[model samples]
Target: MPTTTQLVISGQSKPGVMAQVASVLASAGVNIKAFSAPEVTGTGKLRLLVADLEGARAALRGAKIRFAEETALVLSLENKPGALNEVADLLTQARINIKCGYCTPSREGKRAIVVLTVSNTEKALSVLRDQSLDEF
Candidate 1:
């Protein structure tokens, strides 16, 4: 799987703020895979996982949404039960801790896509892949 970094933006915590930001990404044909609003004081923070980071950033800027960039590990995992636990264990054994993680299954039950913010994703991927487990 191809890995890409996501951009996070912050702005006033008000209605329509998220909507407008989403609208820009939608208009740009950038699929939003994952998103969230982790609060920073009274303002809201927008986290976006998109296919076209540059295009999404441009659109957000055009829409006047203050934003910043950060790196994240994006991966697909088995959709069955215990799959998540196995992945976490593999990372733990390798000493590559997970900073944060989120997952959503596709329409079918074949796979669950997971995005992980980890201390060392490169090492984690290497370890998991050696075990024939999915990490990317």
Candidate 2:
């Protein structure tokens, strides 16, 4: 697990918007580690965790895309029932607040990459240490 930057982009919820963002990053050789795009009322809020933060930023800037950045905690958890529950319980016990989260699993579904923005990231990481809920 590690701390990384997450880019949040808000844009019109229409066809080709996703393609436009993905293409810019792809052209810059930035790999999307985890991504979520949920649209509401014709607007989409996209969150992305990419391998190359600087490259992603550059690409988005070159494309004139407006985005905001945040510090996020990244975790690798087992891909199975109750996996998230364990983490949530641990955090709850530690009194750490989870602001928002998203996850993606491996191709074979063996493990998941969880991205979280928490109320106290430092405490969250420390509290998570030595917990079985996290694989890394």
Candidate 3:
């Protein structure tokens, strides 16, 4: 399995917060590959997968933004019904709990790219590899 770095930014849920963060990253020439942002009450957190990790880190630090980075597994799965269910089933059987997950479809719409943060990443990776799954 392959892993990618995800940057999580924590801030208030007010308007323009995400835009500000995006602007900062863009100014540093960092491109975001995928992202998830959900708000609860007045607080929000943005999880981002970027093309340039170092640049993102530098930009965030220079801007004094509150953020953290984590390694997340990236899975490429067929874009069809039950695709996510199949992967979730495998993780459940392996006793791996998914902490966070997000996905996007490929340009041609034939495959889906899933990013997951699991309680046991190494074990999950081992299980997926052993099952011979196609990156899902």
> Model 3 reaches what TM-score against the true structure?
0.95
Candidate 3 residue-wise lDDT, 10-125, digit = tens: 88889888899999999999998899996576777799998999999999999999898888999999999998898899999999999999899999999999999999988988
Preferred candidate (TM-score higher): 1 or 3? 3
Q: Between candidates 1 and 3, which one is better according to lDDT?
A: 3
Candidate 1, 1-136: lDDT as tens digits? 4456868776778778878887888999888879767555677667779878889888988877778876777677778889889878888888887876677886786888887777876787677778876435
Best of the candidates, TM-score: 3
The lDDT values for all models are: 0.77, 0.87, 0.90
Per residue, candidate 2 scores C-alpha lDDT tens digits across 1-136 of 6888899999888888889999999999999888878656787789999899999999999999999998999888888899889889988998888988988887888988788888888888888886644456
lDDT of 3 at 94: 94
Q: Between 1 and 2, whose TM-score is larger?
A: 2
- Give the per-residue Cα lDDT of candidate 3 at 113: 90
How many steric overlaps does candidate 3 have?
A: 0
For every model shown, what is its TM-score relative to the native structure? 0.80, 0.85, 0.95
TM-score of 2: 0.85
- lDDT of candidate 1 at residue 90, scale 0 to 100: 80
